[model samples]
Target: MLFDLARPLLFLLDAEVAHELVLPSARLAHRFGLSGLPGGPLPGRQVNAMGLAFPNPVGLAAGFDKNAAFLRLFAAFGFGFLEIGTVTPRPQPGNPKPRLFRIAAARALINRMGFNNCGIARFVENVRRARYDGILGINIGKNAATPIERAADDYVACMQAVYPLASYIAVNISSPNTKDLRELQRGTALEGLLDALGRERRSLARKHNRRVPIAVKIAPDLEDDAIPAIAERFLAHEVDAIIATNATVSRAGLAGLPHADEAGGLTGAPLRARATEVVRRLAAALQGAIPIIGVGGILSGADALERIDAGASLVQLYTGLVYRGPALVREAVAAIEPQAARMAA
Candidate 1:
């Protein structure tokens, strides 16, 4: 609506700068109470997956509210669940300023923002201060300075720190920005890492006497064989949930978009197809062994439904929200609510 109309002005600014601008503006709107959640009652359609009750199936993906800086404000934007951080044990300022780019013609973006986050301690502090009441999952990653061999240590440290705070924890082993992060998704690496984390989850649950689900976020660039192989591991390790994808390095679908040549993970309209296929493959392979949190290029209710039809238990958005603004969430919820109601009936 208004956001689309104002896009020309927003497009005038540098991509990263515009992204930085959105946060403060949203925060200000919060101060005036103009910051609001979706208008309609969400039907109390609570579903338990990964040991958490999500009010609905739509979620704000990990990168949007990194550092937990704005979950309270985001809760007002109509997402059923809000996942924040790719937080590492210590804070590091991602890649560099010009990292985020927009391909308006194709309705896409390319970013190599190497997990710039305000360390785990600050992330914990921020989450503690937020007033959000919905499901909050914290996404954890290893520090860039940490070698790929020792990455498990950073994940372990972050899990130990944010465990008590997160409703669930997501292990991000797929962000292409990191030099060898995706390597962790390999057979031996993924199994070893999850084994260690799984032990920690059990130990912490017993010690604190509280249970929380642990999910893995994966990349979209893999092949058919790769998808099922990963799914097999998830089931074997008893992972509670899987966020079907993170952004991809492939530009296969964005044939006409400008800036398509940029070297980074491709997200938005261009990514919708391949991402959903990944979800479908994973879902079929897992056979409901665990819930799948489908994310990639969801920009509409139809897009959301396609993922669900493909077997995604929940759907998430990132690049779509950026192109469409807060209204996108309301639209997606409105689009899905009727089907959800009919399913309930």
Candidate 2:
């Protein structure tokens, strides 16, 4: 395939450099109407979640198109929906140069790119310029410099701006790269943040005349004892949905591998099982109270199905897309379709 030929060359460059190259080219390709995207789900793959009808349960996770730059490229790849950003109220340069790493042998990636993105002002502008018409979810986060106590203000500001632009707004309190961001996931902090967002959503709904569902993206690195209380908080707070995981801080399965010692979150094959386990536990605790968007290390059709089988209402791909390519999207659609059809029935 074309990507197969390009993979070797892409792998040869610095991970971030290759990424910087791919998106602009993809945007240009889409702009010219030149990409022959495979398109969306086959007949029976549709599944509704978070009050939206997904053409398929497969989606491109946030971070891939951090700036909302290539909806056309992804839509052509046939994603049921796409989540973009981890964008903040103000633009950030992220951590530092060479922040992205490749674990080629493990089919994984590790990144400490703190939420580097254009400010919400420009982010909304970019979303407004995109022409791809599928569902778009905007993932929001706090600026690195924001004091942990004041994080909600940043999230609230970003949420208010993105509410009209997003089909659903994902609050990312879990990514490990940002300083103390995960602390927001703790007991009172988590509860207070959710409560604040819940109140904001109510006001925004009245103002915009729409209640854009908000999903919290949690960390996979939670201690075994914490999952239940987290789930309880979600239910009590009436959070619309939960993205069971963000990339993990653990380097669990990559023993002695290259880039295995990187400082950022680990994602891909090593993360699949841990991520699926979170979905399983969340599903049990949630008891179907709210939907779960499972994402972490899906790399194949079977991997995608594993997340759903474990109770994720929907699944997303990021690291996998790097190792596999757009073909993986269609493969995921096919793999989940039967089970999805049964659920739909």
Question: Which candidate number has the best TM-score?
Answer: 2
In order, candidate lDDTs are 0.84, 0.87
TM-score of each: 0.95, 0.95
Give lDDT tens digits, candidate 2, residues 169-283: 9999999998999999887888889989999999999999998998999999998778888889878877888997899888887899888888998888889889999999999
RMSD of 1: 2.3
- Measured by TM-score, how close is model 1 to the native structure? 0.95
Write down the lDDT that model 1 would get: 0.84
* Segments of candidate 2 deviating more than 4 angstroms: 31-34, 39-44, 338-345
Alpha-carbon shift of residue 104 in model 2 (angstroms): 0.8
